[model samples]
Target: MAQTTELTIGYFTVIFDEHTGWTGGLLVLNRGGRPVEFQCTLPVRPSRAHEILFGTTLRDHLIGEVIGPILIKKCRTPLSMVCCDQAESLSLSASGGVPVALVGEAAENDEGPITNDMLVGASRVKLAGATLHVPIEHTETVEGIAGRFVDLVDAVEPFERIREAIKEAQSQISRAS
Candidate 1:
């Protein structure tokens, strides 16, 4: 029998406000860049203790340890991979949940070959002028990410949907006040 692969990808990002604190959202997309599932967290205001205790690791702590896990836990669908806007989210791979990676905008004409892929670290996958930093253990994910975006436009397109949804939610919250 011929094998078939179905890719259910996810994009996760967190936005922070000085007054409202941090909010996170996760959007899962099918092979065609259509939304499958989405999960968003309530605005989380870390106490002063959290700021002082977490110290230098505060951003990583809130993202990877606090908010990211909450959103990922709410997802019922199993994700093939999650592309994140923050590199701190790469630590989500340690949760032993779905594979997670950070997608960054590549510099202009940055078409050089990906290096350090063979090493046990982040493997860079260039797609549509964006660089996806896949975790070392999930090196096999490169094939799926590449194949999925071949027919689709860009891998980072799902992030737009997630951010827009969050903005709409924020507007609704303010209106209720």
Candidate 2:
């Protein structure tokens, strides 16, 4: 399929540091992979009680329930679809919001049942030369949303930028204190 529509794509991720808690960054890109908007959350350090209560689900709750939603809300541009690199953030797609996917290497998307909206897992989708583990039924949506631009985006690159930005922010905060 060819990309006929002018589309905007969003790459969102949450990074964690044991010393500073968690920080999230969302980068929205146009069809040309240019930045349209970027937003980040301050470090969210939970109490020991929260850690005990959430346990294994702590990461998911923080990234998916807290940080991911706020980052999405802060975006000014209307994103045609969202891409993430981690499993914890996958819960963001369940909101019935714009299409959200966990983008990974093509080799990672093993052939299997595609997880539906009601389910808690993901379905692997091959897009461009990469693998997109999308929530619900976003495989085709991404194929069309990306179109020619899909070839232009090395989806993992934006995440590196976001991570660097967040780390710099943390350093800045430490220096200011």
Candidate 3:
């Protein structure tokens, strides 16, 4: 049997509302940051096929369009018909407020199932088949990196814009690949 390599992929970013004191962030948890990595901020909008394929109502469509591509790209699979918005919201929270990592892999029937932990901390990621979701607490770090991000949020506007641009560039690169 041929061995399949696990791919570490995720989408992460920082968002800020200078006037409202609101901020959000996401980090796609992969093994490490890399040239083959995926992360970005794209204008996520709904498509007609989204409803039919995913069994999503108009309301659901509205929310999914905003973050669907991120999840799909990270998972390296087609979007699910029924999405757990709570999980998606958690992902956005990670994107805007703290560092969040969403991770996944395509499963081969010849191999095993994929879980959420594959993207975040190995101890925290939970996966069912090819679908995966990570817990918020998984952002915990022994080195206090997340704390720095939280403290730096206010000072991270320029860096955040750059991060967003990088994510866009990464997405473009994936499409090109």
Question: Model-by-model lDDT, in order?
Answer: 0.74, 0.74, 0.34
In model 1, which runs have C-alpha deviations exceeding 4 angstroms? 1-6, 106-120
Q: lDDT of candidate 3?
A: 0.34
Question: Lowest-lDDT window of 10 residues in candidate 1?
Answer: 106-115
Tens-digit lDDT track of model 1 for 89-143: 8788889467887776521112343334322477777654577778767767765
Cα lDDT tens digits, model 3, 1-177, are 121243322333323222322122233332233223233344333355865777634333333335443444444322111112123333443333323333234221112454344334423333332222435464343123322222221221223443566556545766997
- Pick the winner on TM-score between candidates 1 and 2: 1
Q: Rank the candidates by TM-score, best first.
A: 1, 2, 3
Prediction-by-prediction clash tally: 0, 0, 21
lDDT of 1 at 78: 75
Q: How many angstroms is residue 3 displaced in model 1 relative to the true structure, after the best TM-score fit?
A: 22
- Candidate 2 TM-score, true structure as reference: 0.82
lDDT per residue (tens digit) for residues 1-177 in model 2: 122335777788887788988889998877677777889999899999999999888877998899999998877777788887666666777773788877764111113432344235556665555777766466677667756575455766888889888888888989999
RMSD of each: 6.1, 5.8, 14.8
